[model samples]
Target: MTALATAPTARPRPARAWRAVMRLHRPALIFWGFFVSVVSAVLLWAYGPGGNAAAAAWQRPCTVDLCDVGYAVDIYHLAYRFCEALITFLPVLVAVWAGGLLIGRELENGTAELAWSQSVSPARWLATKLAVPAALLTAGTTLLVLLHRLLFDAHQVPKGWNWSDNGTFEANGPIAVAFPLLALALGALSGLIAGRALPGLIAGILATATASTLIGLAGPHLVPWKTSVGDLKEGYAAPSGVIYGREGAVTSTGAHIPDPCTGAGKACPAAHDIVGYYSEYHPSSQFWALQLTQTALILTVAALATAAAFTLLRRRTS
Candidate 1:
């Protein structure tokens, strides 16, 4: 009688289902692990303020500065800086969610009958399956952001220039958040909607790639608008005298009369380089706010995916 009474129970928590789902994603996990390991080291090494010698070999004089000096940064900095763009591609990779082939996998393998006959309920089973991937991905993204902040300053001033420019993601703060969320959602959506694993994977990848391309092209207008004094029209001034005119003690030097555009040249000192107008460019706080908002939106997508898959599973015929 006790054995009979103990026969009934809802599925073990969603966690078991979540783990089962994760088992199918070993390839993706490997890819992520390899990527994180390789990229983390690269980022840490590349962002070091100083490293590598061959970079000095690439330095060159600027055409607008007052001196012959040029901007300076090591080759590693350039490499690390390139990492900033990685967030954009994250979406394409993340779109492979557990939703696709989740029900389909069970149906195809004919395991739903045996599994559902046990203590698990459909919703709980689905919920548990999605938790692992979602949590791990989010954690990974957070770590990446912290690393970015730790190794680099929000506002960067390059050498040979006092201008507070060349900063990271000054253009769009939301970019980071939106892309990652987009990736995760896409993955899950593809997996769930595209029943077959291959098809679902492709759909996720393609969707992410498409969005990434559009954002890359149009992100400029969406970010912070940092004010800059770079738009002023410049004019060079010539010497006041023409080579001393061969008389009267040769006291006068070159004379540069200001001209408008073509007629707009200032009398620049001989020691100085070319002078030009610089446009005023400054980033607004809205830039960061927008980015943060975008991040939230993305994260929400992941949560939604989990909810959606659970709902679908609960109503599944199998």
Candidate 2:
């Protein structure tokens, strides 16, 4: 009887932890749910009816050479641009939420300390916080990315869209998902370091923006660029691809040098002893390679930031 009376009840730690996180961030979760739903709906519409109408409109004969593309085409372009813009800025939004609300507010309000006193180690708490959101963000972003890719693949026109465009490239692959995770980690780290909501928010935004900018600038160089050479008489005959470098003259000795005269008439090639013109670019075939490389880089940074957040939390709690 005494043994039974003295026995402590076994609480479900995982469930309780999940519930605590959900309760604390219910508002953010609700907003996220709404945002994902609306974006998904827009993407689906664009994928099915909207895409079909736009394609049909393009097939229609125009009375004039410069005719209007019709309302369907306009709407489809608007939807595509709108979705792309939102997805591109999702990381910034995530950074704001993570830095200002997720970690910073709790630390500032003493809620984190209170929770720590209630049998929740700071590490577990941080892990739960990151895990839940990372899952949610990944799921939402993955769905949006698949939808965006479908839309892009189906509705692409030769003149207006290219796989290598910044907005399109980021939205159409795993980078879409990876970037939000990176932003979340950056924001959490910023929050931990700042130990205040406003400072954390500002720092998080700056860090995320800086990281994103650097990655964007480095994206083209992540993979080996293919060079295309064309005879001087034939002019530059590079295939359609993402041109990363200016067209330059190639000497018979295989040296690449600036064109002595871009506009100096046909005499320029012979005068400079240029045998051909060369261009450095990434072809459509290398799309996945580049995308995967960028995704890996972003994920690595996210992991580092996550580790830093945990380390900071441990030091503060200990």
Candidate 3:
């Protein structure tokens, strides 16, 4: 009965799912926007007026070549503080928010059940929750990182704040982005496992802190280091921005020994017949290569956490 050729109505599942996630997490969305705005303003000030002031201060009238270290310290500390916050503490904030506000709170308050009942399966719901926040987090972190790189490269930032610094290393590269995602996934897994907002938040913070410590300790080991062997008299001078690893002395008999006596005055090398000291280091040129490798490792951790989260979600819902 070719009654009437009727087309099937389209169901905007993805769009609706996105909207539902936004609606559910409106407060978090607002808070994230506000935080990003504040950080952006700080970066802008550093890039513009604050930077100009620092330069002007550096140009202080110097007959004997001495300048106002206090003024410079004041100007630089603020910028350093901001960078430090982003690199060191940003992941903790992400984990807390993801655990307490995003997933845990919803599960705690029973809103998750209500959402799931309304045409959203558990997997789709979890995916939307993670996807939306992950996208926002990525955008925000990338912007801050770019601004940091620009400021540092332009020499607007202070000395002693180089790529090798823990805070600077993270804020200057892609690992900055990866760490936060790992935090988010860990937070979600924590929330699902705890099933309580506050406990989830606490667990997430601890997990993120542990991850950061592990990553920092593993930093130099992430890539093969370049080895340099020089006569002990030449001394061990690592390349600028290179992460130095093991140091040892080599004997004239071709035997490698560790940490032999060194210094322009030390006689242990002559007594022991040491020819040279060898040191392992990763040069500044390896920055991006090592950064990407660490990022891959972090993302792998996040992926595993997300998979575990999905499995847990299935068990809970079933």
Candidate number achieving the greatest TM-score relative to the actual structure: 2
Summarize candidate 3's per-residue lDDT along 259-312 as a digit string, tens digits.
646453577788888888777888788889889988988898899999999999
TM-score of 2: 0.90
Candidates ranked by lDDT: 2, 3, 1
Candidate 3 ranges beyond 4 A from true positions? 1-15, 64-66, 69-73, 253-256, 260-267, 270-273
lDDT of each model, Cα atoms only? Answer: 0.50, 0.88, 0.82
Indicate the residue-level lDDT of 122 in model 2.
92
Per-residue accuracy of model 2 over 1-318 as CA lDDT, tens digit each: 456456687876645787889898999999999989988899889889888888888887878567766798888888988999899999999999999899888889999888889888899999988999999999999999999998888774434677877698899999999999999999999999988899999999999999999988787788988888988777676776474656788998999898787778877778788899888888888889999999999999999999999998888778
C-alpha root-mean-square deviation, candidate 3? 4.3
Q: Every model's Cα RMSD, please?
A: 13.0, 3.1, 4.3
TM-score of each: 0.57, 0.90, 0.87
- Order by TM-score, highest first: 2, 3, 1
- Compared with the true structure, what per-residue lDDT tens digits does model 1 show for residues 207-273? 6677556554444444443322211232222222111111111112322223224333444322233
lDDT, candidate 1, at 122: 55
Better of 1 and 3 by lDDT: 3
| Candidate 1, superposed: residue stretches over 4 Å from native | 1-24, 49-74, 97-114, 154-178, 209-284, 300-307
Deviation in Å, model 2, residue 118 alpha carbon = 1.4
Report how far off residue 271 is in candidate 2 (Å). 4.8
